[model samples]
Target chain A: MPVRLYLSHVGKSFTMHLQGGTTIPVVSGVDFSVGEGECVVLGGPSGAGKSSILKMIYGNYRCDQGQILVTVGDEIVNVADSEPRKILQLRKDVIGYVSQFLRVIPRVPAVEVVAEPLILQGADEGKALARARDLLTRLNVPERLWGLPPATFSGGEQQRVNIARGFIAHYPLLLLDEPTASLDAANRAVVVELVAEKKQDGVAMVGILHDQDVRDRISDRIVDVTAFRAEAA
Target chain B: MTDFFSDDPLLQVNGVTRYYGDRIGCRNVSFQLWPGEVLAIVGESGSGKTTLLNCLSTRLAPTAGAIEYRMRDGAMRNLYQLGEAERRLLMRTDWGFVHQNAADGLRMTVSAGANVGERLMAVGDRHYGHIRETATDWLGRVEIEADRIDDDPRSFSGGMRQRLQIARNLVTHPRLVFMDEPTGGLDVSVQARLLDLLRRLVADLGLSVVIVTHDLAVARLLSHRIMVMRHGEVIETGLTDQVLDDPREPYTQLLVSSILQV
Candidate 1:
């Protein structure tokens, strides 16, 4: 399998003005990558710019310098250098992201949440709904909860729903930040096994987690951001 | 263990049940926190671990139970029976809250110093200099660098923010503390460091704590007594070392087995 997500000399930073016009850089130079069917875990202390890497991979933030190359199926594209139109298409068709905070649209049913990615990618309503139901069942979300809104569910259930949304369409690359943080040992094992199952289906993943158990369960490669920073220093 | 509980428990909860409309939060949940002891509540999400903490800390009203607090005035008062003003007074003087997300428990807009000092200010410590000194002192105790006292919490990393939140809660010198997964968002190394800090703080302050977490290792590291909850009921409860080493419950055994330590 080839590399699905690649970053070479990736550096992301934001400038902040201080009391007397002094500026501070938030995220310094950082580099990492992931391949098809591979799971990478990024670990670091808080404020070490871990979340920034995910955002950059998902096209939410543009890097100050360096490039991010994402290859899926027959296409290879530079995420950082891509035009806005191409970036939108790339995110819509190939890249999927589950944020640290499970941001479900309030009052929207879980079925709708899962199916929205397909709907956004221009799939027919019936086909998308069927796909969403299948994904939810595979992810172990109860059938009765399908039409119910995410807010009615507990933290762990909501996280499962979030994962379902990102995986329902079988997008080539998946980015998850603390996806299993709310789950207990039993449920976390199920989710980790599910991620492995998805990887066997050729879905690539990069997850950020503080839980070493979750990290050990899902990761093929571990990237220590704090250690990387220290070596760079 | 008897010598540990020689003095009366600082906080006693009995037959507690909390509900939201038709939904049950917890039922017949009972526990006691003696001074200088750590009691960990381990449960999956929706197991009512957090609700139990809320009821004990008087943050949530229990529909069917009583939380008796041995007050400084040498009188025992049921927390649920207290009036709003009385609850407010109790909150200011006796208890502290550390939420799962440090950002939720902290005022992110404020500097770290002000965040810690807010507790002192709440309890009527009006002297700015005194508040600053106390805040700096507690921050250092929690292993947060003192030079970052004036930095906004937004600038701190996840681990540092959690430490700052713990410092904020501990600064008030509350006899009883409640923490909901204080290390949930931190990396493993940071979690170990924070656990070490908490162990030291619990020993030094002699503060009784009810910490809610889903991680068994966290329970092993910080707790003396462990309660395993499932579906809003206590499935098992025992000494941390004993229960974790030899879990009797099938669910607990399953939970223990799923952990693949490297």
Candidate 2:
């Protein structure tokens, strides 16, 4: 399989400017790659920088040193050093990320929230909403709740909505951050099926899944995050 | 949709800085706004977001730096270098500024039809029948009753007046619009309604918007990218979701975390 995402010697550390510039190193020398149709799980304990690695890959967090390359239609763009505009363009056209929580514009209905990714991609509004409704149905989100904002939904329902939104668009690379954290058994199974579908579509996925059953079922490889943990001086 | 002009930015601001005597209004702010993109300037009170907005809209002169806008004729002209008449024409035909107060943007004493029709007149529309018909159509589009077209803005509710202001500005089909706290002082439900309307209209019009607001929710709803101002300087700028979800700057992180999650 072709590599869709590759990270070489990626590192991250936070500086506490308010605390007299105290530096806290999070992760260092991180290296991983996800191939098309492959799902790689970042496995480690809490605070092991799994989420940080994911954010770095998504361009939400800037890496200190290294190349985070994403293949876009024959061109390989490095996320670590790309301009903000380029990162935004890459996000719109290439990457899809589902964080642990669903953060959306207040009062935007759940269906619109799910449809927004596709709409941003310039898909027709009617078809985008139809696809959103289909995803919501597949995720077991109540039909009535589709018209309501996900903010009012239960934790599990909101996660499902988030999942639907993330999966609504066709992105070459998808990042899943605790996607099934709040899901029930049935919903979790649905997420597993969604992962299988993405794999069938030849998407490259990197996820931080704590649910061992879901992780074991979906992960083609487990990258131990603790090996990249930066030691405190 | 062609490759030639599609990649050209609609507006470009290079190192725009403004000062109120010894104090900084905004310092060295710069960004490019592409067509059909909405960029939000966000910060706490007194962060110079409004000052930046005013400078971008040509309402206030900057102490330094230049703003260049791509005209309908496809020539990039420095806003400061334009003749007064040309600037006024651009304001009337290609640009719109929606103030925080509807009264500031509207003629409160005039009937809503006149308020909307006045913009048409500014752009050389003279036929009374056509102007009134267009005004009535706009009122319907903004969710105001067609019969309310004859009512003056002062007689309308705050939200209605604001919507009227929007209709008046959009009547000429301006390609670029600058909004300053467009939903600042409305009830939550009312704000939601207005936001929904604004979002739809912006998308439909393919407008390039520069919106200044302290409300992060408003910024999130209306903007594609966000520039966070602090102490008269842009502390952080990025795609809206990336900045809001995982802010890199400490101040930005504080601002994002401080929002009451009710």
Candidate 3:
């Protein structure tokens, strides 16, 4: 299978500019290649920088060294050091991210939050809203909460909204951070089924999931992140 | 025919033809729909799929031909041959038709709950509380907010309205359903998700569906069997997988391979 994401000798460090430019290193010499239709999970305890690895791939955090190449259509992009505009473009076109938190403008409804990705990509507003409603419903988020923003929603409800927003786009490389964390068992099963469907559609996924059952069921392989803990400078 | 019943086919459509003045809408179509089977009738615009669907579902009278429906009593009754009241009863209880536009199928001014419960009320379910409860349950089943059951369907968006229409039709547990481009106007993602929901409902309810759509993808996703129609005539008929994977007819192959520009 053709490789969709290739991370070679990746290294990241946080430099405190005020503290004599000292560097706190995380994720040094990390190498992995995720093929199309494969899901490589980041597995480790807290503070192991799994989220940072995702951020690096998403171009939210800069890598100090090595290549974070991603293929979109026929183009291979080095996401680690891509231009800011190109990174933004990639976020819109090639990469989809679902974090553990729900972040939306205050007073914006859940439907719009989930629909924004498609709307931003020049899809019709009515069509986008319809698709968003379907995703939110499938995630088991009550219909009453759809018109309400996540600010007033419960933790599980917000998480489901977050999840619905994430899977609304068709991205080749999807980065999921604890997708089913706050969901109930039934809703979690819904997400599991959705992930299985996406896998069958051949989307390359990288996820950080604490739930062992979902993690084992979805991942093609586990990338241990215990060695990537950001140490004190 | 006795052959259809012995094999348990739910509906037999034979030699169905329709004419709109000098223009022929459709001509000489025949097929059998079995229980739990989804049969998609695919054709280009004005290719007579809608006309055929209308004829089979009793929305329009065919100029010449007969549609035989297997009644709940396990008897073969010609749909067009039935009395007005009997046809209406069959439409209400035995079959469902999902329109492309939800507005045509729904009561615009009434609450979504009322729209869903209207069928139950028509079928002589008198208890107000049971009807309301059932409406709420159906709304939940279609992923509508139970709280919004009191709100009118006009207040909802297109996808929500389409889903509500589906709930209203399916809540009565109709043995057969006729869908006219159920996901036509929706976005790609919306279409995908709605297809998933429809697949789930069909499986759960053991529904027999005769859906008319120009979209080959829709046919591929839902239909057990597919009958390709063109120029108001049946061109090819086979299992959906076989027909889609290896189409024998040139017209069908072109239709299948034609890129969906939508």
- What's the lDDT for residue A189 in model 3? 89
Off by over 4 Å in 3: A1-233, B1-6, B260-262
lDDT string, candidate 2, B119-235, tens digits: 999989999999999999999999999999888998999999999999999999999999999998998988988998999899888888999998888888888889999999999
* lDDT value for model 3: 0.84
lDDT per residue (tens digit) for residues A1-233 in model 2: 89999999998888765566578899999998999999999999999999999998888887888899998989999999986667777888799998758875667899999998898888999999999999999999889899997777887788889899999999999999999996789989989999999999999999999999999999999999999999775
Give the B-chain TM-score of model 3. Answer: 0.96
- Cα lDDT tens digits for candidate 1, A1-233: 67888887777544322233233344555677788899988877887777777877776666656788888567779887764335556777788887535554445689988898888677898999998898788778899999997866887778888877876676788888887776777667767877887799788888887888878888999887764342221
| lDDT by residue (tens digit), candidate 3, B1-262 | 1121235778898899999998999999987787777889998998899999999899999999889989999999998789999999888877888999999999999999999999998899999999999999989888888899999998998899999999999978998999999999998767766786797688668788999998888887788678898889999886675566545566776786675654
| DockQ of all models, two decimals each | 0.01, 0.36, 0.01
Clash list (residue pairs), candidate 1: A46-B157, A46-B158, A47-B157
User: How many steric overlaps are in each model, in order?
Assistant: 3, 0, 0
- Backbone clash pairs for candidate 3 read none
Candidate with maximal lDDT:
2
> For residues A48-101, what per-residue lDDT tens digits would candidate 3 score against the true structure?
789878988887666778999999888899987765435656887789998878
| Candidates arranged by TM-score, highest first | 2, 3, 1
Cα error, residue B115 of model 3, in Å, equals: 0.2
